[model samples]
Target: MNLENAQVQMRKGILEYCILHIISRGEVYASTMLEELTAAKIMVVEGTLYPLLTRLKNSGLLDYKWVESSSGPPRKYYILTESGRQFLSQLQTTWEELQFSVNEIVAKESKGE
Candidate 1:
């Protein structure tokens, strides 16, 4: 098995949660989100991000507004809906639980348990 493949799968698994968390902070544009994700070493691209955004919107977890821009075409800014907020809250709890469980297991392994 390829370790690189596993690493990619791990990143993909949490991409949605990370994106939702970022949007929860405030309204954001795709480029801004992409930049932040890159800075965080998430290794995402526009092609991957756009489809995920559409899926989230279709699921009623997100909404977007098109704002006119003087530089060029209008930009779609994403904002979390009430349902999105509630969903994210649930994800937050799940993440914390998973984090604790993973840390405990890793700690045991490190001790040669």
Candidate 2:
């Protein structure tokens, strides 16, 4: 596959985790989230992000409030729930372990071990 297709394939698996981590950092509106993800070189459309946000909310991992904007209609700002913080903690541990293991494997292979 081409580089773009390959990148998309790789991002598909980790996008949800990355999104959650970003949201967990602070309350953010959908547009801001999209901007942040794009800046990080992770392209996510509203179609993808909205559904993921809905699922996270449904799972009680996210809470949102409608905040009135000065220029436009009210915007929904999402924040991590208590459960989300706990869940993210667990995910962080798992991610660290996976990263360590993958790094070890790559290092060994590179060394012809």
Candidate 3:
């Protein structure tokens, strides 16, 4: 695959976790969340993010409130629900395990070469 395609594939694996971690930090508007993710070099569009947010909300992992915005009518700010915090904790554990496994494999491959 081409470099761009490969990068997109890589991001698909972790985007959900990344989004949860970001939203877990505090209540955040969609625009701000997009900015933060983009600044972190994760390419995401509203189309992608909104659907994921809706899914998370539907799953009872997130709660949101509408806040007045200077630029717009009102914007929805999302924060983690109690269940979301619990889920994030579990996700963190899983992420750590995956990171350790990947690091070990990479280190082994490097040492073998």
Highest-scoring model, TM-score: 1
Q: Write the per-residue lDDT of candidate 3 for residues 5-109, one digit (tens) a residue.
A: 999989878888999999988989888989999999999999999999999999999989998879869989999999999999999999999999999987775
Q: Output the lDDT of residue 3, model 3.
A: 100
Winner on lDDT between 2 and 3 is 3
Model 1 stretches astray by more than 4 angstroms:
109-113
**Please, what are the lDDT tens digits per residue for candidate 2 over residues 1-113?**
59989999888778878878989879899999899899998989999999999999999999899999999999999999999999988988988999999999877755546
Per-residue lDDT of 1-49 in model 1, one digit per residue for the tens? 9998998899999999999999999999999999999999898999999
> Considering summed lDDT, which 10 consecutive residues are worst modelled in model 2?
104-113
TM match of model 2 to true structure = 0.89
lDDT accuracy of residue 103 in candidate 3: 92
Q: Cα lDDT for residue 80, model 1?
A: 98
Model 2 lDDT, full chain set: 0.90
For candidate 1, the 10 contiguous residues with the lowest summed lDDT are 104-113
- Which is better, 1 or 2, measured by TM-score? 1
TM-score-sorted candidate list, best first: 1, 3, 2
